[model samples]
Target: MIKPTERRVGYGVAMGYGVTDLFGGGAFAIIGTWLLFFYTTYCGLTVLEASSIFAIARVIDAILSPIMGYITDNFGNTWLGRKFGRRRFFLLLSSPLMFLYALLWLTDMNYWYYLGTYLSIELLSAMVLVPWETLAAEMTNRYEERSRLAGVRMIFSQLGGFLAVSVPGLIMQFTGKDNPFTYTLTGLIFSCVFCLAVFTTWRCTWEAKDVQPEHKFKAEVQRSSGLFNHLKYLILDLISSFRIRAFRLHIIIYIASFTAMDVFGAVFTYYVIYCLGKDAAAVSAWSSVGAFAAIPGTYAFMMLLNKLNLTPSSALRLAYSSIFFVLAFLFIVYYTKTPVPDMVFFGLFILNGVARAGLIYIPWNIYSFIPDIDEMVTQQRREGIFAGVMVLTRKSTVAIAILIIGMVLEEAGFVKGNGIQPESALYAIVTLMTLGTAVLLAISFYVTYPFKLTRETHKVLLKEIARRKLGGKAEDCDAPTRLVIKQLTGYEYDEVWGGEATRRVVGQVNCSRVE
Candidate 1:
């Protein structure tokens, strides 16, 4: 029987764990919403030139995220991690690094300097975020609880987006357009907020007990080593991670799905300003409603996943299908010049909002579960590796996507600081917004459809992971069978408690579901 204390997490801990999303969402939104425009208009670079600079930084991510994940996962297995907290140790340092945001919005920096600044922020964020994201897997092994954690994080992520879109727009309204100081000031303010949330979370929670490897492996890892050795391990860790079948498929499909988002988010304000021929107020109204709509949409997705009892791949396909249908219809209406009433326009934003919820939370919630699969293979908890790849891939795609969007704008003859764009540019904007979005979403669906990992398979995987963690040998079950077929290998003793066998047989174990 599960003890009461074992089953429930404190509200403070849960909320604190979640509040970091406010920082992540807000910071990313600020960059996503306006950084490109800032480059084009304020920094005096052409769209193509600015995009080139953004693309350069993506090269850095090829090394950055995986390294951090390797460090964090190993660190959690080390003495320092055991004493001071694995994930929490890094988080403590991450908050103060928020001050670095100031440099990003600084003026008089040349393109090279700007590239360095952009990369610096990316480095700092990875230091904190790779570990932070891994916490979802560590914090709980329960499915619905993981969903709740993802929900809380996404709701705040939307709030962060809300602030990034609305507040900055409101401030810039008074300060006038492309006022450089406006960005500097916004950076400092949100930087403070990000730091505070991170520190507050650190104060409220402790790291969950991550499973450690046997002594020989642990000792070799803990020996302070040179950079070359570290790089070797990172490469090995990555190789180990890619061995998981579902992860490879998931990453490819996720990239395709997220490209649509990167393009749409990069284009939203531009579309409103140019295609819709509207102002900041209109953009704010649309963004605010959309962000607010995501909160309800998150729970709505949770309910759908629960009630339909769909497999992850199936649920993902359905979600992407909804997005495709909406964007496709919106394109047809706009392209053909159907007289869209104000209500219809707002309703489309509402639908977009709901889709955004799935896009943000569903894939991420799935990330926590994937570590279980990796753990089954390596016999070590490696949430950081999987989480790192997810972030790394997502970040890489955003870089390519933003550059692509910028190039598209330049090709269409977009001009900066001019309220009006040419008819071709305007046409390009609407077409990209509608049909471009539809095609990408459809691609995501097709990418996801062939995968396995059904819902029933996932439950059995969780049970098998629990069995192993409890010191019961699993006989290295077949990956495709998902632990339903068990060969007797050997026995495992409870490492922490130093007790008798938690189990010798794989026959039914009584594990209760905790909320």
Candidate 2:
């Protein structure tokens, strides 16, 4: 029988744990949507200058993301880790530091000042997010409970996107859109939200018990060496995650799916305003409604996975299909000059909204189980490293997608800060928004076919890991469990959980700790 306290992820725990998405989702939404406009209009920076700031900061943060992951993974060996826990400590530290995000919106800042502030906020976000992301896996082992946690998290994330889109517009209504002070005030409000959300997460969430002393000692020994050696080992450790077959597939799907969204996001406004000859206010209204619509969509996806017992991959295909249909409908209506009603457009946005929630939900929901798979091979928990790598890949791929979109538009004779565009530019916008998105979704859909992780298989994998941890031999595995292990890890039954495969992968770290 399950103990009463075993299921600590009640509604309160899930709410507290998920609330951090207010910052996680809102901060990015605000920055991505408004920062460039704010810099160019009020801060007296050119488009190139503003874009360069983001590029420089993102490049710097991409490097730090995995290092922060590696640090937290081994941090259990430290005095601070012993006292406060490895992951939540960063949440506590970053709570107050979130206020620095406000500085990025302040006007009259020089280029260097903007760069410094933007870099600071990005680094601060990574420091907290990389560790905080590992908490769901650390807190619970049940598939349903973890799904609940991730589902709530995505809902809040959608809400954050809503607030990010709406709050600034509300502030502008009172303060006037042209005033720089409006953005500064908006930043202060969001900073407060971020601070409170992170603090609540720290207070309400808890980490797992410490790992084995031997593992901790080995981590300490590696850190005790020269900085160069420590860096080398960290690099090796980060790369080692790719050796896990499931993670490799997960990353591919993640990159392809999200990059598709990025391309669509970058081009959609252009498609609406330029291609369809709609107003900016209409686009903003559509975006706000879409954001709000995602809340229910997220909940519905949770049901699809939890109640309906749909695999994440199947759910993902459904989402991609919905989005694919939306894009196609929009393209067809515009190309054929169909007299579509406004309500119909609104309905399409609602459908797209629902689909996007799955796009955000499934990969992350599936992510909570990945550490269990990793534990089966290494006999250790390494959620931090995987989180770090995911963040890094996310940032890098998004940057590339945005860059490609910009280049393609520019090549099509698009001009910045101009109300009108050439005919070719409009065509380019529709093509990227429709065909480009469809292509990426196609890639993701194809990749998902080979993916075998589902609710049922996850249970099997977890059972095997538990059995092995309790000193069961791999040789004694049942045929069904053995097949599942081989399918998931691409390792023979006897080659996992500290077997020959472990030595082969572990030996990549040429340190005395393991030898």
Candidate 3:
């Protein structure tokens, strides 16, 4: 096992760590953009049936994320955890399993077969993602280094997204666009890509030696031994993450922001094909060009957060505002039925790409620092639990939203693979693409008002945590630092850092007594 170092993270480490998002970003981009379309057109499924497959698989995967997180959190006590690594072990395990992704594109399968394949891939995704997401925190504590890692990761994510859209478009050009085999070939190619990316991440990343203390692990291992007790602790640990004020707010922001995008992605194809009267190839071409716009958008936001030190909330608000404009513009074009030129549509894709980049980038960048906030209240580095909770909320909510979108389209008399949709169906698609996204963005934008996290405040919070760790008296905390601590944790100074107030929280759980 390679020992983690305290040295600064360089470009090599950053690229290695970031590469796995090819799976993270690319796989999902393909699904969100085209999976339902493929299912309806090629697999002979209704809108409701297609969406049910996504919702069911994601809901199950969402439930499992935390369990996987807890296992990795304590896996260090096991031989595999000690030899391979708590987090990277799963990365190594999931690399080859990525081949299962190709099965999803197979045609003429029964509904159960489709459901089973989708569920398997979603579970595999949780296994790979739950642990991998924690590596950014486990790898480095520096805000700058963490930001660098996230920037590179999102860039690769965008690149994966780029390939996800572009490759399909190119493939379909050679092999007829309407052919089901086009999607099958796309899936097979990306499955190989997913396999390689996960393996690369396993090689490139290292977990911090001091992340989990010996005393804490011994206690945790003992507590989680029995089946019933493990279940109890898992539930408590997963729920405990929300107790941190920052984490709760972070989750609200994550769900509201991404769910908006999910709705847009789910409906955008139908809107393009039906509302705009364009072909599938046009959807792919415009989206692929937008993917190009995201690369620079990601880099610009990286500089905003790391160099200019923009507050995350401020950056998010800016991004959401841009997104809202794009949505409104699309609505107008559809509503007015103005015969817009190609350049105008292309311009909208460019703007959407830029806004979506910040939407994707800032929440995750903010997430890397969340455990630091959690550590203050719990005195434990429960990054896995935090990561688990984040994934759980994200997957569950996105699934539900997809389900609702599916239901709405079905209820509106949407027919599978129809070149022409009912007036009702077109109305539903346009409303979902515009009004649905606007509502989510509005909620997310409202939530960002009270969020006060920034680089300077985070630095202060970390310093106080260090002071508490060194056995400094809580009373010694200066006014400004104390306020920063209180604000971030949503607890008064005495109530945190092993204070009696936290005795009921997951951090202070006494597993021996629970039995």
Top candidate, metric lDDT: 3
Between candidates 1 and 2, name the one with more favorable lDDT. 2
What would the per-residue lDDT of candidate 1 be over residues 343-374, giving only the tens digit for each residue?
Answer: 77678777777878887777777777777665
> In candidate 2, what are the lDDT values of residues 274-390, reduced to their tens digit?
788885456667777888999999999999999999999999999999998898998898799898888888889899989999999999998888888877777667898999999
Clashes of each: 0, 0, 0
Per-candidate TM vs. native?
Answer: 0.84, 0.92, 0.96
- Give the TM-score (vs. native) of candidate 1: 0.84
Rank by lDDT (best first) = 3, 2, 1
lDDT (0 to 1) per candidate:
0.70, 0.82, 0.87
Q: List where candidate 3 sits over 4 angstroms from the true fold.
A: 1-5, 210-224, 507-515
